[model samples]
Target: MADIRIVDVSLRDGNQSLWGAVGLNSAQIFQIAPVMERVGFCALDFSSSTHMGMAVRTDHEDPWERLRVTHQLMPNTPLQFIGTGLRFISWESQHPEFMQLAYDRLVANGIGRFVVLDPMHDEQAIMETARMFRQAGCKEIIGALVYTVSAVHDDAYYADLAGKMAASPNIDRVYIKDPSGLLTPHRARTLIPAIRARLAGKALELHSHCTIGLAPLTYMDAAELGVDVLQVACGPLANGSSLPSAERVIANLRELGHKVDIDDRALRQVCDYFTRLAKVEGRPAGKPQDYDASFLRHQVAGGVMSTTRRQLSELHLEHRFDEVMAEVTRVRAELGYPIMVTPFPQMVCTQALYNVIGDERYSNVADQLIRYALGRFGRPTTPIDPDVLDRILSRPRAAELMHEAEALPLKEMRKKFSPKLSDEEFILRATMPADQVDAMCKKGASKRHYNPEAAGLVKLLKALGERPRQSRVFIQQPGLTLDIRSAAKEAN
Candidate 1:
């Protein structure tokens, strides 16, 4: 088995999730780097070459001066930064040379480890990028398979792919990157072993999101299968868009007879520091309650909820809480409720329940709902009962629910969830008004119902009159606000 490693991707992936969250000064990166290194992370997934251009254009100086400072902060921990094979936005195309320029500049610095992020799942592109990096003298190159899933096949297919990927001479490591947090435990157990079998003499790492709340368990399974490295985010910034917890995973692995040398106490302090920072930054310290199981199902079923409070307010669907609840049930039947894919679904579902049952019983109802969902779905460790639900629903929120019920579409709602048809059928069924579908496609550059195929939708929407909703999906609290240099002095 390859020796285990941990790469703290909080700076790169963590910051990417947070909106306006990446302007941290060098001192900030420096401050966080040691804590991570002390916790036994092998490298820092520093920042993105794609987003770096934003900092570069906005500032007169090099935006990654913070990364240089991070080097000093973590003199020992290697720096592993990201380079993308595809640009996320058309805006990047406006400066077509940014990708190569960014790669050159990042390498010019002391960055030793590079994650060639192939968002399109194009192994050929990754191979070409690997060639370029090898030519650039980057010895430790990681090829990332972003949003990768073997759902279409069984473990054997994934294992075969891993073996083939391991044979690449230029690639040092293969990171199974699941940006959407979709990997399941059963699948992990099956696939990890298969991949290990194929890569018996090669290095393999697993980088996944906890979207389905499976990170902790999945990490354990991967370790058991002899994964070389795992990714993690530090703390409260830890869960939402962050990777699985490193200390927890390492500790769990050690208990299961694996050798890992992580400082648990230091990890705790780092978690505390970021938790406190999140509060100071005006983002809630704890995970948001609105993203419970129901909300996760909504997303999984290709249902998109408006994150803008204004849009939600305009819907005025409060009075129709029961109807929305009915819709939730129907959609669940169609797509499986508590899809249990999102680790934080309970947070969103609780908010949705609050809107349904009102504040009077919101907590109790939410608790019962989540508990029931968990138990029903085989995660019965969390305590929840209907009696407790009854108690918490007796407060002021009950009245709030009654008031909001007036605006809800009690009559127009569908009563049953049906299997999703073809791409055209999904768009026609999921969205209202053909014009709205076109408008949304134009805005998001994605198909109306498909999250992955939204490139065209994102562009079309931008071309038309609508703007894509600000993606707050993977953002952190205590968001980065200033350019790197300004934040450096501010941090000091």
Candidate 2:
């Protein structure tokens, strides 16, 4: 039996799938860092550009500081990050100098591995990102094949792409990423061997989700076909829409006569801590979900679904979710079925919601959709529907967009913005609004580390210690009653 290695995605994809990527703060991650470091994982899926943006926007935490602190705790382990080929975290493409400087800072802050993907399956863009990673001194660069079901994306199609990725000298590994959890065991039976045949003995890893309850079976099939690494998550963060549980995968592998090198005791400790932390924080724990065939239609990712629901709730349109979802299916096909991953899924869904709620179909198209039709994002795998294309292009903005010039280079951007700012600050300023950056800068670094379980107890004790002279503390439970009053009396 071949030995199988596991990459833990609890910190990155787990939180993304289960809690919308905004559930954990820097303090919470810091409290659990040491326990994660001891779990004997082959590598840790540490952070992503999305996670960094969420930190700055929602938690007011310095993303660079988060990386530096995480690296300090797990100095021996290789930390991995994910990004699109040209864009850092935003949907728009960034300047090449900005991309290079971001990569350099990441490596200097202790990121060792990068998983670069182009959502449009553009080979040149992926290779360019790989080159940038190499130039920035990253130790390992993994090219990603984003899996999706479409007429144009057959096994042969994927095999050809995998072959090209394997031939790239800059890429040390290739990742088959099923972010939507759509890969079934039956599909893996043929797809795995086809890609494996073209890999030329290069390392290949499988990263799938459990949204439809098919990933565990798919993982087994891929392992039988000689996949080198299986990406999984700890128990509290596993199953559901996240990856399969590490403990379950280990047991299944051993039952199948494969060898896995992991410390069971340490894994248990990590699981137990996270389980309690989820409860204390009032967050949902990952659980196995029954298969949902409707997922094949919308194809929204696990993480994107959470954010979508939140968005609908914010707009008071939660009741129209089913209508919006059905519209998404139609919209995806009209736009030529762009793979349901970051940026694309978000772009498609935004346009769909606009159509569903705007009182007239195709009356209000999003700017991103217009940009997509103009080939600003990338070329689509298949041709967009003619009617939809005409409607989008007929808009007056399309003419204005056609006349737009190229984005400014780094040198020009420096002059346009401020030239004195550091690359990190400049990049943030370029991507985010100045008010958001100012708010993040004002908050500064967090001083106190948070342990969810202990935090609740601390709050309760502090509340009990602050009783007024005339006030009495009352406690009543089944078969127990207690009352306490402050000893000091009010002066007349």
Candidate 3:
């Protein structure tokens, strides 16, 4: 049996996939650190700029401290950071110096590896990002060949791209990031080998979502096709739109005569803990998905879909979802079918939302979309629809964006924030709103431990105690019992 390694993504991709990126906090992750360390994963899909930004925006947790502490607790496992070499926190891209500092601070706070991706699949940009990470002393750098379904994206395209990436000195490996789960087993048979042929001895990894119900099957094909690593998630975080479940993938690999050198006992604990945590938080656990053919048309990723729905709900326009989705497919094609990954997906969704809600199409063009027309992100896979491009560029806003200011350089950027701010704090405060960063600082560092089982039980006890009229209480289950009596009632 040939051996296949695993990289756990429960804390990052799975959390973002199933819970809108707010699922696991620092304490919850810390609770499983040692067990996860023992599970023998090559790395943890640790965090993204969005995930870290949300730490301050939604949870008021200091993500830097979280990573620092996690590194201390799980000293043996490498923590992976994913970046597009474009921007941090904000949707707009940043200057190279800004991104360089961001990457350097990440390495300082325990980010050992970087998954360098460029949403536009720009090889030059990807190589540049990989070099920046290398200069920051990143232990490993994996170039991402983002997979998408389009007339231009094919086996040869990926193979050629992988060859270029392998030629770069800074990139240690290449991974097929199937965010939309569009890779079928049929595609993998040819695509995997084609890419591997040009990898030039660097390892190949497969990271696919279960969005369209094909990733699990595609993963098996990947294993047989000699993918060196399979990125999987634990229970409650796997399946559905996330990656394949580690438990299921391991068992399947073993039955296929492949050796998976992992601790099953610790894996079960990891699964059980996440399952319990999901239930306690009243969060939906990922379930196996059905084949959805419509996914091919839009290729909108799971997280983008989730975020779109949330944003629509916030705007009290939830009922326009189907309309918005239809507009998304149309907008993507008109915009030259850019790969539906970070930034591009956001741009498409925003334009679609505007089209659906406005009186006329292209009535409210997003600055990002306008910038794309001006050749800001990269050359689109195909020329944009002429009419749409004209309309996008004709807008007065587009004219102003044409002469947009460049991002601040490192020394100049430092002038905007207090000199007292550390690199971590300075980056956060500069990229995010000052209020959000201040609120995170006010919350203090997150505690380092979490007891999943005790969470719900403690809430129950607190609820029962709030009832002044209640004197005594008793509870029993198949394997346990608990009884409580008020002091006043006992005295009576």
TM-score of each: 0.57, 0.89, 0.93
lDDT of each: 0.53, 0.86, 0.91
Q: Report the number of the highest-lDDT candidate.
A: 3
Residue-by-residue lDDT tens digits, candidate 3, 1-492: 568999999999999989989988889988999899999999999999999999899889999998999999899999999997768988677889989889999999999989988877877788889999999999899999999988878899999999999999999999999988999999999999999999989999999999889988898889999899999999999998899999999999999999999999999999999999999989899999999998998887776888999989999999999999999989998988899876788999999999998999998987778889998887787799999999999999988998989887889989988899999999998889999999999999798778876788888999998999999889888876999989998888
RMSD of 3: 2.6
**Model 3 accuracy (lDDT, Cα):** 0.91
Model 2 lDDT vs. the true structure? 0.86
lDDT by residue (tens digit), candidate 2, 335-433: 988999867888888888888889787889877789999988788878899999999999998888877776567777778676777777777777777
lDDT of 1 by residue, 3-36 (tens): 5677776666665554344534333455556676
Could you arrange the candidates by lDDT from highest to lowest?
3, 2, 1
Q: Give the clashing pairs for model 2.
A: none
Residue 410's lDDT in candidate 3: 82
In terms of lDDT, the poorest run of 10 residues in model 3 is 84-93
Q: Which number leads on TM-score? A: 3
**What C-alpha lDDT, on a 0 to 100 scale, does residue 358 get in candidate 2?**
91
**Per-model tally of clashing residue pairs:** 59, 0, 0
